[model samples]
Target: MIVPLRKCLVPEFILGDGATNLANRYIKFFNPKKVLVVTDRGLKKTKLVSNVEKQLKADNISYCIYDNISPNPRDYEVMEGADVYRKEDCNVILAIGGGSPTDAAKGIGIVSTNHHHIKSFEGVDKILAPMPPLVCIPTTAGTSADISQFAIILDTELKTKLAIISKTVVPDTSLIDAETTLTMDKELTAATGIDALVHAIEAYVSTASSVITDMNALEAIKLVKQYLPLTIKSPLNLEYRNKMMLASLLAGIAFSNASLGLVHAMAHALGGLKDAPHGMCNAILLDHVIDFNFESATNKYVDIGNAFGINLDSSNPASSKALLIEALQEFKHICGIQPGLKQIGLKKADFRELAQKAYNDSCIVTNPKDAEIADIEKILEYAW
Candidate 1:
């Protein structure tokens, strides 16, 4: 048996129930005189950033906080963040929010050093050099931007999401603190949790799936299955939250290398076009994409069933698929996650425009099955 060999790497992964201390401990090694903390305005009110600030203060470290970034972090914000890093002479970055801030920091680190247009780095391997050493501390349980080598910047002019995929984009360290995630709103909790589900499912049946990726992806699915709803019900349950944080990071690592399937590609287009919540969009489209790809990867569905804790005694693949899709719908409903693009303010009129954009998205290339413009339109129709 020839197993595909791919290195799983994260310079430092400090994950546990209260592992935010990793930030203080690891800071000693990086030893920068000044650190720039990239985060969004919303997170500034949360204790997550304050906890890190306290850690830095305790260690006698100096850091500047850049918390002006927004939901769909614009390219200019990244450029400005780089400017702060360069001018302050900060050698290390501490990303203190969810995906936007982490993704922005990655973009900032890249263009800050390379002095290239942010748009120039779109697509794969555009940045050849190392980015500024970054340590990500994710506040939300979803959007595994911390572990992945991917950064998305919304092009303010083009009004599109430009994904920067490079190995250097993966954070040098990930400090996952369940306490930090406690401040999240209920909707955010549901959206991000379901987004983790999408990551696991996509990676499990990814076109490039390998044994290593499958192991992590399958485990991520199981963790999500057992914990997503529980954490939602008991938002402050440390035990459930701990499971969720690790699941997000695990899913991030799995999909980062295996590459995401159609759900992400189409959702990216919808997100950029509608300027909506990224995780919410993924939650809406995940089940539809799973059903669409079921035929192409039915055997993989058995593993998905097991991960989701579904019992499938049927030998027929089609029956198994029926069971799986039913489980998926039940998963969404159980989590109390909202469905329908219309719920997110999307309508039939937007489908034509969004489908065209989704077709050109970079994520579509790695989807298990090819989705043409019409298929994307149909999916949007069903999701709406």
Candidate 2:
């Protein structure tokens, strides 16, 4: 058999404790005229953003802050941020929050340099020009937008989400400091941690999955399974927190190359339509999508079982699959994740639109099992 060609992409990442402090060094290296520090209002209360500000001030690196970002970043937010970037004469983008801020920063870069509306660059590789230099300090570990080629931007007019899949949107550098994640509440930690798990699982089973991506995905799954609950119990435990950060990084690398599947597709729609949390949406849809995808990717599911520490009986595939599902369910319960989409205000009437949008999502193309609108609707029903 002739193996197809593949490519892997990742950002220049500095990972460890106090890695965020290196922001000034990178800023000086880039030597931009000025910098835009993109973040959400919530993170402003934490010392993390302030610390970065202090460092930038100490280094005399002129910078401005765009703190209007929300959990699910919208099109207007990107446009507004682009205006800020251009008006402030900021040539570099520095993001200092979770997925929202990071994703927003990517959007700001696109519009800043491309001189086009953010929504115009919705689909894959729509961006022709390179974006401004981006430096990411990931506060909560999930979305992986800092390291990935995917940027999810919500369209306020359409009341849905669109994905911008392109290498140009990937950050130039990421400071993965575990210390920045210490201030996250338990709910945020659980949601983002599970989001990392879903990223690994979907990437591992994707049709685009390569040997390298599979390796990263499996390691990410193991780390999340082993450390997520512990981090919740001991939120201040740097060891567990750092491990989860590593898992998120590994999963980001994996999914950014391999792409994701139904979980993300559905989550994107939920986040856009219901104004739900991306990680929470992923957490709710993950198990059901896994179950939907199991038959087509049995061997991969067995691998997942192993990653989750479920001893699988190779002789009985059904038993192995069940064990994996049980393990995931137990983890969900331990993380205090709510049971269904209904809990997040997903109405039955909204199922059709959600299903159609998910079916059209870019991530759905790589799913192990092909999901049509009906199939997606069924999955949403199950999740509901």
Candidate 3:
């Protein structure tokens, strides 16, 4: 049997307490002319950004901060950030936040170097030029934008998210500090933790999944199931925080290599359309997508169930599917993520449009089950 070729891509990452402070050390290796510090306004209010700024100042590294980023980063914002990068003569991009700011940084890096509109680079491997050195400090436990080869930017005119999948946009280094996540409120923590779980599950069942990706995905699933709730209950416990961070890293590497599936595809579509929280959107759609894709990846679903500590009866596929879905719903409920699509401002009228957009998303290509627009609409109906 001829094995199909597969590749895994990951950034050089440092993990642990105070890892964010190492950004300046990595930036110095680039010997940047000026660093473009990309982050959201919300992070500016925290000491996290200030601490990094202090490190840059100590190293005498010239830098400019572009904190005008939204939760769902816009194309205009990327263009604007690119302009800032050029105007400041910045050669290195340092992102210090969750997915939003890191994704914006990737967009800025692409636009600054490729000299094209961000929209043109949508889909897979469209990036022609190498982006500037990017060092990411992810404050959130999920999204894993710090280590991902994918960048999602919302197109303001089209009101849809552009999925830019390319190796060129992957960061040079990631500082994955669990301490940074200590400041997240219970809501953010729950949403992002479940987002990591979704990443692992999707990657595990992705049609493109390789042995390497499966190992990472299954371990991530196990860690998330064990640690996510503990972190939520003991919000400030460093041990739980560290474990969740590790889970996020593992899941990020898995999905970055194997790509995701219907849940991410639908979540991206819903997030782009409603400007909703990406993690929350994933949480809402995960179990429904699992139910839809279960038969297509029955063995993989059973593996995931085992990781979740549910002893699914694999001999009985129907019972196994029901058990997995019920367990996932219970997990989400325990994590305080109970809202459905309808509760999050999605209208039944928008289902077709959302499904069409999701079908067109890059992530759908790796889904275990091939999904049509109508199938996605039905999934939306179930989720609603």
Candidate 4:
């Protein structure tokens, strides 16, 4: 008997109270004379960036800032960021924000050193050279690009999303400070939290899943189920925020190893096409995709239902799957996630194109059920 080979990759991450305050230590370890700090314009208004800046300044670390990143980061944005990184002669990259800025930072690292357009690196393991030393501080408890081996970049010309997956693109270090998430609005909190849930669910049910990934995915699901609502209601509750952050980190590790499934594949297309929030797109499509995938991976769905605190009987797989979907709907509603793609401005006319893009996404390859173009189209229509 031959045992299948499985490898896991993860970035060095620090998680706990005041983790962001340790930026100076990590930057010092990089031994770079200058750092390129990549983030969005919106983050500059918050103390999250300033807090890290103050720490960097205290340590006498020189840095350059590129804040032109969009909510749905574009191909051009990555190029522009790379230009700044080169012109500033920055040796290290520091990303401080949600998924967009972190992913853009990864793109910048790829293009600045690889001498290729960011789009060229799209798909799994296309990146040849290792990225510049990167330090990430995530202000949101979702996406988990800081630790994951994936970067999502939008192609404005094609109105689609491209995924760049390479272990080399993973950040050298990441700070998980739950305090940073306190600044997010209720909507952002809900969206990002649900995005973490999607990651765990997709990873758990993915055909690539292993025992190691499954453990992390299940724990992440349980943590999100227990803590997401508490964080949403209180907003400043540090305990809940920390749990959500941990869940996000675990989910990141799970998907980074096991890969994602159809929910991410569909959400990536919808988000790239509309320049929409990726997390919210996942939130809208998660239950629908779960229904589509239930028959193929009923045991995983039952496990998910158990994590959600539902008393799902695995013996009755059909009823268990329904319970799982219903629980997800109720959980999403409680977290204030608006239902349906129509609420996010997706039109029926665009479904066909979105389905084609989703079908082409690499994430779909790992889905437990093989999804065809027509099946993807129906899912999009149903989501709409």
Candidate 5:
């Protein structure tokens, strides 16, 4: 059979200055009876929700707002959201916020429509039923969860995250407006923006990398190199925010197709075990993973440096790898990311056990180079 190098799921992405106002325009497209607005308490308290609510109210859209989502959302929250959606007779799910709330919405949509436990379907393609017409509006510049078919759901009972992969999880519509990200604090904006960079970089060299995914990843990297710092320094600048948002969107698309690697696999393990912030965990592990993968991907490291404006043309492979490591460290420093997992309250004593789980993560299989448990332990030590 003749097939493309990479298979991707497309979403109805609505981008513009005032894309939020176009909700009513596409409402008939989904033919949803009731709308479920999934978000977190912070956003509902902010003007972002007020702005979107105003538009929905103007259109007389019947909606219910569930804003109790947590940072690392637990399994129970998915069931709770499903309850709310069904109780309100919601046929459409509108998710607004960062990865946590958005991912929670996908979980809710699946369980609500499928009439089953979210945990019951944990692996790939376990979602056999179609979800409601879900729409996602990302308020952050990172966590490309907005347009992707993947949702990283946490099983708080087990204290680990699950990558819920299914084509049905891709939103029916995405309302991306850069202006919403302007209010993010400097730290979160930088961290999430860097997270997006990691996504792009990992996808660029993934074993599954295809021509289409490579284009998306490379473009994302170029844009991230140009815009992440600007957004960090000038969060209110519409141009900078717009650029970062676009980069994140591209990164999400790239990784969604090519898939992520050990950086995310290992980071998610750390976050689950220590309850660390997803972005912070990723930031802490970024350099270590890059350094760990350096020997196997010297050419890719050079490309990463070149993408970030490092003059590596005249540099040797070892020098280029070192330069890439230094660049990643510098990127984290500029973003003011935390020093290490130790600083984030991860007990170093737990590293051995955590390393095992991280190594077993499904994301590890598709990394450009596979590492054994010893390698993962060393990476943890480096991140330490």
Candidate 6:
């Protein structure tokens, strides 16, 4: 038997209670003239950003803040952040929020170093030059943009999300602290938790899945299944928050290496077209994509069901698939995600365009089953 070659990419990371406080030490290692602190306006209302700034100031590290980022980070926002980086004479980027801020920070680094519009580096390895040093402090327990080799940026004109995959975009360091997640409300928690679950499921069933990625993906799924509901119930429980953060980290490593599948591909399209929440989009489309790809990867789906504590009989693949899909829908509702595509403003007429964009997304390449535009449209219809 022959084995295929595979590679895993992850940034250096420190995890625990005080992980964010180490920002000063890591930024000082770069000896940057100034740091570009990228974050969204939502985080600005919290003490998370100011707390990190206090640490930077204690180390005499100068920094400037850019909070012009939105939920689905736009192309122009990336360019604007790059301009801020240049104008502020910053050599390092320290992102201190969720996926939007971290992804925007990556985009800013790309344009600032490569000297190209953010839209040019849309697909895989389009980045020719290495980005500036980046340090991420992720406030959300989902997206995992802190360590992944992927960044999602929305095109304002096209109203579509661009999937940027490259080792160059990976951060230099990630400060993964569950403390920051304490500020998240129940809705944000449910959405992001489901996003991490989708990442694990897709990675496990991806065409590129390897033994190493499978291990990470399965463990992540188990963690999310067991702890996500507990966190929603005990919103202020640090222990629950820590578990979800670890789940996100493991899922990030798995997907970053094995890549994602149709769920992510279609979710990206839906998010860009509707400006809807990315995680919510993934949550709505997850079970439908699983049903679409289940026959192609029955064993993998059974494993995922086992991770979810479902004793699926692989011999009865059809029954097992239906049982797993039913459980997934229940889990989504249990976690408080109740909206479908229509509730989020997607129309029946838009399915064709959304399906076309999803088909063209880089993530579609690794789906366990090859999907046509019509197949994606069917998935969208089912999700609706």
User: Which tens-of-lDDT digit does each residue in 53-92 have in candidate 6?
Assistant: 8998888889999999999999999999999999999999
Tens-digit per-residue lDDT, 80-147, candidate 2: 99999999999899998898999999999999999999999988789999999999999887778879
What is the Cα root-mean-square deviation between model 6 and the actual structure?
1.0
What would the TM-scores of all predictions be? 0.95, 0.98, 0.98, 0.97, 0.96, 0.98
Tell me the tens digit of each residue's lDDT in model 5 across 1-384: 554566877687988698876766666577768789999998998877887788778878888899889987888999999999988888988899999999999999899878998987776688989998888889888898889878887878777787777888988889899988888999889878988998988888788777777788888888888888878888889999999999999898888888888998888788788777888888888888887787777777677788888877434877887787888788788888998888988776888778887787767777888888888888887777
User: Which of the two, 1 or 6, has more lDDT?
Assistant: 6
State each model's C-alpha RMSD to the native. Answer: 1.7, 1.2, 1.1, 1.4, 2.0, 1.0
Pairs in steric clash, model 4: none
So what's the TM-score on candidate 2? 0.98
- Sliding window of 10 residues with minimal summed lDDT for model 4: 1-10
lDDT value, residue 88 of candidate 1: 89
* Residue lDDT tens for model 4, 1-384: 554578999889998988888999999998988999999998987787888789889889999899999988899999999999999999999999999999999999999889999989888989888889999999999889999999999999999999888998889999888988988889999999999999999999988888889999999999999999999999988888889999999999999999999999998899988877888899989988988989899888898899889988879988898888888889989998878899888889998899999999999989999999999988887778
TM-score of 1: 0.95
Ranking by lDDT: 6, 3, 4, 2, 1, 5
Question: What does candidate 1's lDDT look like per residue over 1-384, in tens digits?
Answer: 888776665456777767776687887688888999899887877776788889999999999998879887888998888888889888889898888998999988998779887889988888978987898888888788988978988887766788778888988888777778887777889888988889888888888877877888898999999998899899988888889988888888788888887888888888887888888888889878877888888778888897789876436778888888888888888888776889888889988888887787777777889999899999998899
CA lDDT of 256 in candidate 4?
A: 93
- Runs of candidate 6 exceeding 4 Å displacement: none
Off by over 4 Å in 4: 1-4
